[model samples]
Target: MEHPLGVQPQMGLFEGGADVAAAMRTRGLGALACLPDEALLNIMHELAPADLARLACSSRALWAFANHDELWKGFCLDQLEGRWDFQGCWQDTYLLGKQAKGFQPGSRKMRRAAGLQSDLLYTPWLCATCAIDPSWLEVENVDRRSGLSVAEFREQYEIPNKPVILTDVVTKWPAMKKWSRPYLKKAFKGGMTPACLPNCVVRRFDKTFCETAPQLAKDYTVPEVFSDDLFKLLCEARPDWRWLIAGPYKSGSGWHKDPNSTSAWNGVVSGRKKWILYPPHITPPGVRPSCDGADVASPVSIMEWFMSFYEHKASTRCESVGYTPAECILKEGEIMFVPRNWWHIVLNLDECVAVTQNFVSEVTLPHVLSHLRSRSPALVSGCAKEARSGLYDRFVKALKEHRPELLERVAAEEAAKKKRAQEQHKLAGLFKGPEDACPGVNLANGSSAANGSSANGASKPEASGSAAAAQNGTSAGGGFSFGFKL
Candidate 1:
């Protein structure tokens, strides 16, 4: 059946085998019940499998809430690694698997959900199926172009830090003709790489993996406009930048900026993608970044945001802010350039296949460096142990050794920024009522925004191993951990 968004969800196993969304309306668990699915997931995320199983036995209603397959998928990913071959669903698969910790697979009897049909239960099922409202798309489109040279692209979009849809670019990619579900499945049939299904793995599209999966990597090349990624100076130490993305209609991330203050290019190889983007300055409705910016809170699913906030709330925000979002329905073989720190969400119009790569270039080199230097190691994505701590130093050292010219430019830019900040501070001080405190650092001057931007603006990307990995937080705009959706 068609959903309000005009697409039907491909039927699959265990789609509505949860009571989470129904609880959103009924307060089935009293104060703890009927919250948004993300709130429920957050609470469940802290519970162990044993605890969840215990909750299942509390009552028939909580049984439905606790037995969610998505929860178990997360538990499986957290406790184990590699392929998940489900024996009915993730819960049955993990508990029955040898790696199961506290419970045997299928050890506990699940209460049969018999008379639980309602619009409320359908709420969870609709989240399982299709639910996006077509009316959510009341916004303007980004700029579009064809046959633009690299210099023109930089002048019009990159340097100005604006998003644009490259109308004709992806038509040249071999992926537009070659990639699809059966073909991708067959390409990795030899299993040189463990093919991922439900819980996807972030394939590092580096040299070795490219040589092994030449068929996949050779399908597309980075468009020249964004090929100047200065992060290449860090060599292999660079974060996870490219991803192989696929999902059903409505399966995508919450609103977020790219991590490490990098810009991006996303090209669809198959199916259409719907995109809504807010500029670096405009945070989308229902999205909140923590004070430290180490965490970003957003609606649990793409559909929820569009349904709950896209109309009046978004319009009111836009009217108050005097700006609107840049939006589009990206068709097959069409690519998008997402500028640095732009808040964006990509929803699939159907089963879609795509590749997105994050990058840093002259336009954003200074901002990227500042972020790496200031943020806590825990908030950074795609580094391990010592590499994480020394990332900023390593990038700088590499830039100084090789791209000395770029480093010099970055230094000049930083100096100019400080000068601007100091001027703004001095101007503000003219209006200052004598509280006799104007330090050289300008901390007491109260107009520090002129001097420089902070790294706290970037979203903390949840890397591999959680079921909700891709739910709200994003890294490079897509990725997840142990059954977590990235």
Candidate 2:
């Protein structure tokens, strides 16, 4: 259909050059003017920063399109490489980074749109406000266990590689009562260091937030089930482990595994969080993680993943089969155990505050060791500088000196595994039976000895092909078969 504003839907808005753009301007964007911000942003996405900035100068509509933070953010990143020195939105980063060295930013004023709902601007708000259908919560399931002893946990879920929500684990944490957003905002009075800012370094933002205010660290303690963190052997030199995560609705992590092949526990302080977890073997729908675990190719936004793939996953996911993922709402004061390297994504259903820690455990030590040794140092993370440089060797050395029992147990386990393998090799082709059957064995002609058969006497003819198989109990190819007539 022709656009009411006379735009040919087939033609791009700016395809024919400045004259064409001027004509479109005089003619107005027509249907393009009426397009949803997202679709219009898609058109604007094709433009270069200079062209986009020029377009912003042309008119209010184009200015709105051109000034989007996302557009500038993409430009900010594509324009530079390595650690970002600037902090703020991509537009601010671009302006900040583009300034001459030692540039001192001045007091700047931000232009306020009078309730303009640009898809470039307001769609994120819409995604945040979109009501989560109740049925969305009921599609999949994971077991919920509480009051499990360490042995019970290891024997049942940890060893079996399953995800579970532990209800009573974090119930007594002081953070559960004290760590509201308002309290946190007050507790977090100081500004974050340059390294803690988003797009900076490898540490979690939550840890950075807590590091800025050391008092916040006292609000929670490690649960008994996870108190066996092997990283503690490295003490102050261990990699950053715990974090204080807080976010508004519709904000949370994308698909990822925890760092350094460590299992994790996320204990919610307040509000609701929806968790969707798949085992180590199953990658969540629409996620493509590189094999070495460095880069992820998937929708960076939680809303994008939900809007694009969640329903399809829910509909096709089967609880009794491979596609089903463990799904749950982790409410206030609850702790969730995410096994090592299991793929998971967490979405906040409300304003939320939580603490999460990734730690190496006895169950995951070997896996972490293999990951540390096999991956390049650049890809390895979640540790101090000295540990990061030679994590596998350092960890093994620490294990031998301080935690020799762990190594001894693992060595014994390895020896047992090798013994099982040897036993399997010895019995490769044998099965239980009362006696052996021999083919082409005859007591009168010593056919049994000639055919390497030890069995009751039997006579065999020189039948060939199918005839041999039928009369002499021989293979169709004329090879002797083992048989015995009891």
Candidate 3:
């Protein structure tokens, strides 16, 4: 059709244009800029730190708005869990937080006290370490060839409290085939959802506040042996203990223990990782306890510090200390155990997708219980309160309902221990009596009736053997083993 104005619509053109214009009005800059400053900021509050950075670069107005300290302050409190003046620059503070998870220093002295060299610390020394000595660390690897059984796992790894990478454990999980960087990026909101990148070594995308990878809960399930997690039972209210960790190279956790002394298992669906573990007895060099003697803080990334130490081991002071660290190259379709209280560092070797859960099992129940009782009973999210006493009692009841035999066995063992302890106490006291010490001694008055008149008008005899020895000019020996005349 032709129009007099020479702007005639093509077939369905006017209708399509109306739809497109309406969509733009709802989604495009018109929609964004028309929003009030407060509403715009409220929308910006929903953005992740990385997205916020990108938004600032989008335009001058957004740059000014995103740079507001008030916005960053709220971000610090929400994302970082606390607020600190990073010299009145919330962006620096926010970026510092993204770099170092759980870093909030109120003062320079606080940073120093935390063993942090500076408020902002990141170094890429892992690549160098892998090049120089890839297998320098000493973590144990259990391949399919090892033929490890449940019994062997319990006795050697769980009971003895050690970490091991089991290659055959998760070979059948659907995630191994389905999860990939490209696939996930496409399926899960254009791969821009800032994952808990191990490169940053911080937990990312809290499901409590954000949605998750649609395929996570389906493709992966807890490994068979580790499915009986009591920590999860206690922390039934908290779903954050389990994490779907996905990130690019050089991203993983820092040198830290799993919260509340819970043991954990990590299964790699795809990609490889460098896992380093330190036993509870040996504190990794440069790891220091905070002021409370409870929490620990690190100055440098664990990998960097350990790498420097490994490179300088020949003439360095660490040679005198002589600590062996456990390291492993965890590959795809493999699972690893991180024992309770073990300090560990995980660095992704490549684009990685993994699942991990902090757990307490029958083996670690007692330790987890002890950890819980030591902390404040008020249930705060993510702290090991799930391992506490009152919560553990509830867990025990639940276990009794589902797995009564297991509870019965534990009860029987505890009863037997108590019986043995009581028997030992009686046996220890059996030989102790008044006659065993001083014969015929009076309790009411400190008088030996052996050589004095008793209350009943009877005289007890003194030691005649000693009296005879003295009369025979042989002094009764008391102090010295060798007889010497003084």
Candidate 4:
């Protein structure tokens, strides 16, 4: 029903202006205390951020409910659209004060000394001569014929949040075949430089590597390799990868998670690389130690932390406590599988040709969608004070009721699967090498062969070809594969 102001009563205030304000001060506490927990949450949800902050300050009971992480999480998810940049937040909230304390009158050397140093420990070895244009990269829509049907591929390969080798595409590009270590060094020596910020490039130590190469350049930009048509197609076909080619001397992209709520795959064709992975679920406790403890004072990026521990002489002691991070080296023709939501840092060991794509595959869409839906209330409420308070309360209730079981199940399943895989691998080692020496397989010539053949015949072949095609009949080649049994 419409209220006197022509708005629905539920959407409008029914009480008088002064009375409502007074009631908020006097009865608000009682209302918060007396309301059933769920209803109280619902009411808080109807309030705005200012009102929520006010409620938080009113009393210990309100404060407890207001400051509950569930409330802030929901507030963040809803209002911020899950795009809270930790670095940006740190800059605004903490770095300003830190920088101010160190400020002094003009001295270029001192100013340079005080500036934030690159915290990246492991840098990707890139061809030093190439230039990269950041503007050349754009998000793309999916194409139907690019190996896997977009939807089907997204289901099997993308959603499961595992990396896959994209064959045939870009393999014929000049960089894939020609951009080698020598070529990169020569280009850099000739004075090639990157055309834009945030572009990738290779750094070389010696002029000899540069003298032996062709297509020498000081730097390259995206405009040279990535055409508008190519960029548009990539953006359309694989909008998630955020595709960009590295310029000479630019390390493989710095360590960071893909922004689209999932993990990503970086497929290299001409170069070798190293990857350091930190399971997204793992969180280090206590204050993170600063790098060098004297010059660098801020918390280290997770990548710097892992690399420092990896390269340090005291590595054994770090590993003994299980603080040493997991690292993988991937070479050309090999695919590195990054699990969903894992934080990974990559270094290209040489001038490399690679395609990096982010995907939301079948296994991961539910989680991604749930994350998206959870942010809806924030958008619906705007940045109002009362509505925000209400949203926070609702979030706390949902956390109490829904999230714990899922977290526990995920943890248990991961533990069990790891244990089982280890056991199976150990058992399989006993039967390694020629079957002729395996007692079970060499029982008798005819008997062993006959029995083995029968056993092998009884089972199915390991599933091959595109995972998407295996699940559905659709193929990346725009054909279908069907099986017929008589």
Pick by lDDT: which candidate is best?
1
Give the per-residue Cα lDDT of candidate 2 at 184. Answer: 57
Q: Each model's RMSD to truth, in Å?
A: 11.0, 14.7, 22.6, 23.1
TM-score of candidate 2 to 2 decimals: 0.65
Q: Rate the local accuracy (lDDT) of all candidates.
A: 0.64, 0.63, 0.55, 0.37
TM-score of every candidate relative to the true structure:
0.69, 0.65, 0.54, 0.32
Q: Which stretches of candidate 1 lie over 4 Å from their true place?
A: 1-58, 75-124, 138-140, 190-212, 313-322, 420-486
Residue-level lDDT of model 2, residues 1-486, one tens digit each, is: 221112222234454444553454434344576566568788788887667766666654455456666787677556754235545445556667777355455433433332233233544434544677686577547778888999988867665556788888678887777765456546766244222222242122466655677767787888888898898887776777887776656667889888777789999887688898865545577888675558889874787778778876633211213355678999888899897777788877776667889888777776676677654665688755445758777788899999998877776766776676577644532432333344333435434533434355444333222332323322121112111110
Off by over 4 Å in 4: 1-175, 178-193, 196-240, 247-250, 284-307, 311-326, 376-486
Candidate with top TM-score is 1
> What is candidate 4's lDDT per residue for 243-262, written digit by digit as tens?
43342323554444443343
**In candidate 3, what are the lDDT values of residues 1-486, reduced to their tens digit?**
221111212224354454543343244334485665457767877787678867766643455445555566667767765323244356667767676554554432210111111111113222222443455534454323245776777766776566777777688787777765555655565444434433332335334212455555677777666766765544355325777777656556777777665788888887788876655544566567553335667644545655655443232122124545666888888888887777677777777777888777777655554455444444223635444435545656666777677566566665776677678656645544565455544555644433365555564323233234333534321111112111
User: Candidate 2 at residue 65, lDDT?
Assistant: 54
lDDT of 4 at 251: 56
lDDT score of residue 219 within candidate 2: 78
- What is the Cα-based lDDT of residue 249 in candidate 3? 63
